[model samples]
Target: MPWLATAVTTVGLLSTGAAHADTFVPLPGGEISRTLGDGTVVTVRLVGESATISPSMGATPVHRNAWVSGRAEVQVAGGIKKGSIQPGYVVGCQVDIAGGGVDGGASGKTDWEGNASGGLTSGGNLSLGPGEATSFVILDRESANDYGDESHSSANSFKGSEASVTWADSTIGLSGCAGYAQARAFVKVKVQTETIRTVVTLWGQPFSLG
Candidate 1:
C-alpha cells in the first residue's frame, strides 16, 4: 500500500565517535532530531534530492520507504538505547530507506510509496565455531500463534557459520551456515510472541591457513 508523506522535526544532539576514541558533532539547535520514541514521527529535508535509508545497526542493510518533507522523528533503535540517539546514531537520520529508492544494494528489501526517508539500526547476529552446530527460533508478539514466523537451525557441525538476514516492516530473520563438511543435518526454529532475539557470537583463537 502507498503511504502519504508526513513531515516532522525535532531538536537533538548529533555526536560522532572515533574508531579509537570518543568524538562529538554537537548537532544542537539544528532543527534536526534523531531520537523519536515509538509512535513518534519527524520530518527531513533533502537538498534537491533524496537520500539513502537503511538500518545502521551492523553490516545488515535492510531497506524501507520514507519521505522527509522537511524532517523525520527518530523512532526505533536496533538494540542499544540512550536518550533519543544511541551511542552510535546520527541525527537527521531515523527511518531506514534505500538510496533514492534506486539500486543502492540495501541489505533487506521493502516497498515504498511517497518520498522515501528514514534510518535503521540492525540487530541480531549469529556465529559458529569449527565442528559446531546451533539452532534459532523466531517469534512475533503481535500474532496469536506463538510461533508467528519460521524457525532456523544448523544441522551438521561446521568449521564456521555464515549469517543471512531478511526483514519485512518490523520483522527480521536469518539463515545459512559455514564450514559444513558434507554432513547430513536438519535445524528448526520457532517464532513466538515476546521473542527476545539476542545476538549469538563465537569468540576464540584465529584459524590459520597453510
Candidate 2:
C-alpha cells in the first residue's frame, strides 16, 4: 500500500497548482517556493510524522469474542490571529493558493481519527476482538515579516516546544475505520494577503505514542 504519507506529501504540499499553469518545480529536498500574482511568497516544507507503535501483543484472555477502540488528537500552531498564518491564506483538506499575498485559514476540526477492528473467534465461543488507536500532531512554520507587520490568529494547541518525527518509518497504529487501513489526515493553508515578499515554511509531525 502506498502510505498515505505520499498523499500528504503530494496534496499537502502542492495540490492547488496541480490544475492551473502553476507548475510545481521541485526544490532541493522536496522543497518548493513560488510567488503568486499579488507578490506574496509561500514556501513549502514537508515535515514527517513522529509518533509510532510497534506491533506488539494486546490485552488478551484468549476469549472467542473481544473488541477495543482507540483514538488520538494532535495540536497545531496558528489560528484566527495575526502572524499565526500568512495574512490572507486559506486552509482546508487540501492546501490551495488563491493568488494574492493574503493568508486565508479554513475553519473546522483539526483531528485525525483511525481504528482497528476484528474478531477473535476461537473454540467457537463467539467472541469479537476490536482495537483502536489515535494520536496528535503539531505543525509549525517560519514566516518572514519583511512585508511589514502582519497579524494571525493563534490555534488552541499551536503554542509549545515539541519534538518532531523525521521519517515515515515511525509506526503510528492500526486502522479499522472503513477504508482507513492506511489513513492520513492533517491541516493545510493557503497564502493570500501580504505586504512585502516573505517566506513561510510549514513544519510539523505527529506526536509520539508508546
Give the alpha carbon lDDT tens digit for every residue of 1-210 in model 2.
111111111011112332322221111122345554554444444432222222222322221111111111222222211112211111111112223111222222322110111221111112112332222222222233458744222122211211122222211222222211212223233322334323244423212111
In candidate 2, which residue ranges exceed 4 Å CA deviation? 1-29, 48-53, 56-180, 183-187, 190-210
| TM-score for all models, in order of appearance | 0.17, 0.27
Local distance difference test scores for all models:
0.19, 0.23
Q: How much is the lDDT of residue 196 in candidate 2?
A: 33
Alpha-carbon deviation at 166 in model 2, angstroms: 9.8
- Residue 127 of model 2, lDDT score: 18
After superposition, the stretches of candidate 1 with alpha carbons farther than 4 Å from their true spots are 1-20, 28-71, 74-105, 111-147, 150-210
- True-structure lDDT of candidate 2: 0.23
Strongest candidate by lDDT: 2
